[model samples]
Target: MTRRCIVLLSGGLDSMLAIRIMQEQGIEVEALNFKTIFTCCQDQSAQVARDLGVRLTVVGQEDDYLDLVEKPQFGRGKGANPCVDCRIYMFEKAKRFMEQIGADFIVSGEVAGQRPMSQKRRDLDRIAHHSDLDDLLLRPLSAKLMRPTLPEREGWVDREQLYDIEGRSRKRLIALAKKYGLKDIPTPSTGCSLTEPKFSKKVFDLMDAPGESRRWDYELLKVGRHFRFNSQTKVILGRDEAENDQLRYAHQLSDANSTASLFPENFLGPRAMLIGPRTDEAIEFAASLILRYSRDYDAGNALIRVDDEIINASETEQAKALQTIAAS
Candidate 1:
């Protein structure tokens, strides 16, 4: 019988190379791609699966995935990314997938010592143990340096064909990609917002907020310019026309957390969403921001629309000052 394995395909050079190695050894491979709100490379994964001639399964993070992001047991990296906890969550799901599909083992592209947060030698052992795939999980790119997994030990795959690649250098990996005739070698990137410093700041701010941040709050982070009005209130301003439409649509959602939407009624200006009480003062503050960003700023006290009612913009100085403080 032909051996089969499930590969965690992240649409990167390493995962693609892993699939190639499995194919070279005549092992049937199935690709699995995991997605979270912070990840943005599903399309690339799908394309890579097609290129590799492997069946692909796409799985999204469950609500519990947020728990790790909010408070990672292993702490975080340079950014908000909880790499160790996040990988454990993914591998746990992959274990279920492996059983569901009757695959003999699971494989990934992780190189030992490649990633500071998640791919340390000790971290790899912790992930395998925690995910309950102790000897079933294989990292083909670094297999030679680790204990043989079930596949290798059982002769399902040749340990000699596995690699000992580790660390941050991609010189060997790039050469291997060319040898395999793989095209469109993607550049190295985590493709996750949680790994970005600026975005991490926003995530940390939300985490530090008084109340628990909802999924909607996290989703909104991708859409607008966020401003904290107080412990109970935040304002989001659209930076472009498309984002303005998104804000309008988001505010109208049945489960939206926004209390009010603001825009310039008589002049061109960016739209804003209020995520807390739409008090008169908050509305005025939001409108003042609209005025500051409006194209026709001198169009005599900008007429601002607050949901259905029009209000004269006020608190211009206060809004400007607050924005300055936030930026600084």
Candidate 2:
């Protein structure tokens, strides 16, 4: 029987190259892409897999994924990204898939010292060990620089055919792509919002706030400007018409925590959602915000539909509450 491998294809040039290398050795390759709420590259992955003529399987993160984000065992990177822990999670799932499909080994494009968070030589070993792959896991792009894996030891894969590329430089990698005759080299992208500093600010905010953070709550973070009224109260205001439609739909989710929604009935303004109470205080705040963001509305002209009631946003409210946090 010919040896086979499952490669983690992130729709990037590195991963594409990894799969090509395996094919060069006559190893049957199946590609797997791990998906999370923060990941936004499914379409790209699908297209790349089709181009490579490899079957692709996309696995999603389970709710337990939230636990690591809240309190990572290995800690976080520059932002809220738990890179080490996240990779371990992905590999643990990949290992299950590998066994299910009887893949001889697992492959990734990670190079030593290429990523500060999880691609260090030591980190790679730890990830492999913890994910229970150990020598069964292979990094073809940097294989020669490291100890031989099971595939190499068992003569299943030729170590000499693998590479020794390391660090952040892409010069050698681009040359290798040319060697493989790969066109349409993909540009680098983290593809996960957790890696963005601004986006992570909102993530940290939700984690710190009172009450359980649900999927809907996290989804709203990607929508618009956010303001905190208190531990039990908050507001989200859309920045544009697209965001306005998104907020309107968010309020209707079965599990949405929104207490009320503010829609501009007679004037142009953003649609806003209230997270907690619908008290006069929250209503007044939400209304004032709609007006503040409205380009062509005044206090008297601003008519906001609040649940079943219509309220006039006063340019006259004593003072707007101090903004706890802005858009992230």
Candidate 3:
């Protein structure tokens, strides 16, 4: 019988190489791509699965994912990223996926010390144990360094054919890619918004707010200049045409918390989404921000559309009254 394995293909070079190595060992491979709202590059992952001729499965996190982000049991990285906790979550799912598909084991491209937060030798061990994967999880890139897994001990995959690569250096991995006749190398990145400091600031803000931060609110964070007026009030100003369209679409959602959306009626400027009360003070504040970021500020007679009505920007105070939380 041909042994099968599920590889965590993140569309990065390391994961791609992991798949290639499994194929070289005459093992059947399936690609699994896990996506959270904050992750990027799914299209690239699809293309990679096609190049390697393996079936790809894309899975998304449940609302419980938000719980982990807000209060991580294992703690966080430099930013708000809960790297260790995140990996455990991913693998717990992968373990189930392996069982569902009747795969012999799970494989990943994780180098022993490549990631400071999650790939430390001890961290790797913790993830395997906590995820309940244990010896069933295999890191082909650093297999030689780890104790023999079921695959190697049972002769399902040759340990000699696997690698022992570790640490931050990519020279050996890059050379191996060439040796496998692989092209289309993707630049290395964490591929997660939580890893960025500025993005994490907005995440912290949403989590710290009084009420719940639903999916819509987190989705909005990806597309605008965020400003906090108070605990219950905040405004998001689009930075470009694309963002303006996004803000408009967000306003139309049935569960949208945006009390009112303000758009430049008589001048060229960004749109704004007002969350919380639509008091006159808040409405005028949104209008003032539109003028503050207007590309054509020379148009002194600028008007703002609130709902279906047009209104002049009354400077309740000033657009810069509150500190800008996140830009664009």
Q: List the RMSD of every prediction in angstroms.
A: 1.6, 1.7, 2.0
At residue 178, what lDDT does model 2 achieve? 97
Tell me model 1's lDDT, rounded to 2 decimals.
0.88
Over 4 Å off in model 3, which ranges? 295-301, 315-328
Q: Could you give candidate 3's per-residue lDDT for residues 108-162 as a string of tens digits? A: 9999999889999999999999999999999999999999998999999999999
Query: What tens-digit string does per-residue lDDT give for candidate 1 at 102-143?
Result: 999999999999899999999999999999999999999999
lDDT of 3: 0.88
**Clash pairs of candidate 2?**
none
Which prediction has more favorable TM-score, 1 or 3?
A: 1
Model 1 scores worst on lDDT over the 10 consecutive residues at: 319-328
Off by over 4 Å in 1: 315-324
Window of ten residues with lowest summed lDDT in model 3: 319-328
Per-model TM-score versus the true fold: 0.96, 0.95, 0.94
Report the number of clashing residue pairs per model: 0, 0, 0
lDDT (Cα atoms) of all candidates against the true structure:
0.88, 0.89, 0.88
Q: After TM-score superposition, what is the CA distance of residue 186 in candidate 2 from its true location, in Å?
A: 1.5
How far off is residue 263 in model 2, in Å? Answer: 0.5
